[model samples]
Each structure stands twice: as structure tokens, then as C-alpha cells.
Target: MKIHMLAAATLAMLAAAGVHAAPPEQAPHARVLQLDSNSDGVIDRTEAAASTRLAARFDALDANGDGRLQREELRGARKGHGPRGGHRGGHRHAGIDALARLDTDGDGRISRGELEAANAAREARAGADPKRAARTGHRARPDLLAQFDAIDRNRDSLLSRGELRSWSEAQRPQREAEMQRRFDERFSAADLNGDGRLSRVEVDEKMPRIASRFAWLDENGDGVLERNELRPQRGR
Candidate 1:
């Protein structure tokens, strides 16, 4: 997919810059090669078939839907990365949206006073329904206030889009690493046989989400998952 190409391009650029002496064994190129079972240089339907995760997005990544995903196609798919913004299809930036909603003056910014007012309004709404309030805590996330305090770099008690964006960018890498760590831990725990792979039954019990797409992840139709199959498609 585009993610794969982006990873390859990144590694290639690093190599050109002398930042990467040689491709690492754990690199995306290695993983892609492993996934490309037929040695055809492309991830064909049969190959990608083992990954429900890939299959779900396969059509989008394929571009031509010819039952194959070329390197170029994967690169093209990386054009507009990240979640879709705005109030449309996918509300990936829900926190940002919530902040915008709190801009009571419609001035495209949220001040501490505005945030307080929003919080109070939410509390009052919850008070009107005690049961619902109890269930949801009738408040925003526990860290919301702390996040705002940190983002308000100047201590002006106000937040701009730029500050929020900066904070998000700063947290991205750490968040991604943590997610990968969690996935690795889960995968390791699920490998009951210590065979370095997970069978369908094991995944069904330990990682239902993956079990749902077992057929797609078993690239060679082996009915088992290799470490490469379970790993994130995005290169390391």
C-alpha cells in the first residue's frame, strides 16, 4: 500500500543521505518480501488475501482493482495521510472538534472562560439526567484540563489551532510507539505454542479482531499467522 512505499522511500532517502548504511533486517522491504509469497515483486490478491486488515483496505490501495497492488499504487495512496477532518465521514480529530464546539463566540478560538462555560453547560445537562450523568461522569476526559494547560504555552488561558496541532504532532511518535508495544505484547501473549506464529483458534481467543480477518492474514492459506503477518504493515 501507500504506507509501504512511503516507508521504502523514507529508507531510500535515508540511505542516500548516508543516514542509513544499509537496509535493516526488520525493514518494511523485508516484510514486504515475506508477504509477497510468489516472488512476483507485487502483493497479489492471493498474497494479500491472508490479511483481513489489508483486504479491508485492499480495494482502496489497489487503485485499479486488478487484484494486485503495485508499489506506485501504495505510494499514491499515502498522499492524504491521517484521519479525515471536519464533521464529515470520519471524525478522527474529535478532540479538536470538541474544542471548536466550545468556541462560544464563534471566533475560531477557545478561551478558558469559554471552556468553563461549556463544562458548566455539560454538567447542567447531565444534572437534568442523573443516571446518564453517573454513567458518563458528566465531564470531559480527566486529562482534558491538564492537556489544555500544557497547550496554553503562554499561560494566556487560551488555545489556538496552531498550539493544538503542535501538541498533537509532539505526541504522535510516542503514541505510535506505545501502540506498537501493546500490539507486540498481545501477539506474544497469544502465541500459546511458542511457535512464533498464531493459529486461527489462538487468535480467535486472544485477538478477536484479528480472528475476524484470519483468512486474509493467512497469506499462503496456511491457517496460521507468521510474525510478519501480525506486524503492522507500516514499515518500522
Candidate 2:
């Protein structure tokens, strides 16, 4: 259950992009349902593989790297360095509330048409009274429509709960791989002594973000990052 530096870095990137001011939380019940596919009370490698989110961080969550995640390990994954480190409870609830609003038909799913309608409503409101809209926080994000289209995988103009989950699952591996490649490049460049691990000074100079959370990543309090500590586990 050691802190996963790459995950933190990814969250940082999302914040920088203004996707959300804080990490979005996954509701505990939803998490169990999504990750524990078999309902066996635990997430094994096979189950985790079915989820892009879980699969990407499977290694880190499997504290012992035993190819399975017990309840304890799952709990650890939720623990993070600071307010912005882990998912924020308010954000999670807000997302659920937003989705509920978008599912106008109460079918528990959102269609592109419905989403567009909602966006239009928000836009109209904003145009009529910009100050009121701003004060009420009802303005729509310009990219929201594009984002909805991207997640509608079947091009059926509808976004079912399953479709949304599938889109995320599909994107997880590519994202994680790209992050891993970047981390490797950075680690190699920062390893001044050509050693596999990085000392505090090396991290301070080369990876300021990681350095800021050094205590969290140094799992053993050894003041250095073992090669494995900075890299994703193989085959993940």
C-alpha cells in the first residue's frame, strides 16, 4: 500500500489541465462493484484486468505483489499524502449528482441528446445573465460536449453507464504505459551515480513533484527510491 508516485503525477496533470481542482473520488460501494467483479470480496489479477483504472495500479494496490488485492490493500489505495493527494469526497458526490441531473429520462443513462440539451440550457442561462450564471456556477465547460462524444464508444449517440466504464477501461493501459515510459526517461536522467536508486538530493534536483512527496514514496524510510519504487511492475 505504499504511495504510488506515478498515480500522484497523473492526478497533478489532471489538475493542471483543469479537469478538476481536486482528484475525483470513487464511491466505496461503486469501487467494490467495479473492481470486485466476481463479488468474491477480493480483487484478483483477472478481475483487476477487466478494469482500466484498477489494472493500471494493480501492482501498487497489491502490496505484496501477490497477484491479488485483499481488502486491506484496497483500503490502503484510498489513503494519500494530502487533501489533493487522494480522491476528494465532495467531488465524488458532486459527480454523482451531476450525472443524475443529466439522466433526464431517469433511465440511469445519459444520451448525447440529453447531454446536449443540458449543455444548451446552461449556455442559454449563461448568455442571458452572465453575472448570475457565474455567481450560480452554472456555466458550461466548452470541452464538455467533445468529452461526451469521445466517451460514447459505440457512436450510438448514447452513453450508458457501461459505456462510460468501458471507455475508461480502454484508456487506462495506454495512459499508464505512456506515464511509465516518461518516468523511466526521467529516472535514468536523474540517476547521476548510475545507481538504480535515487537519493534525496537527486530527487530534489530532478523530480521536484516526487521530491515534495518523498516521505510518502520512500516506503521504508530509507531516504532513497529503489529501482522498483520508481518503476511500474513488469507486465502491468
lDDT of 1 by residue, 68-111 (tens): 55554444323423343342222223334434556779888778
- Return the lDDT, model 1, position 171: 64
What's each prediction's clash count?
A: 8, 0
TM-score of each: 0.47, 0.37
Show the lowest summed lDDT stretch of 10 residues, model 1: 85-94
lDDT of 2 by residue, 1-236 (tens): 33798889889999888895567787764565455543445565434533444445564444322345655456544542123324433222222233455788998778777877877886886699887555444434333356677877778777776665555445556645654564566678778898888999987776554566567667788889875665433331
Which regions of candidate 2 fall more than 4 Å away from where they truly are? 1-107, 113-156, 185-189, 192-196, 208-216, 219-223, 231-236
Error of 2 at 55 (Å): 13
Candidate 2 yields a Cα-based lDDT of 0.57
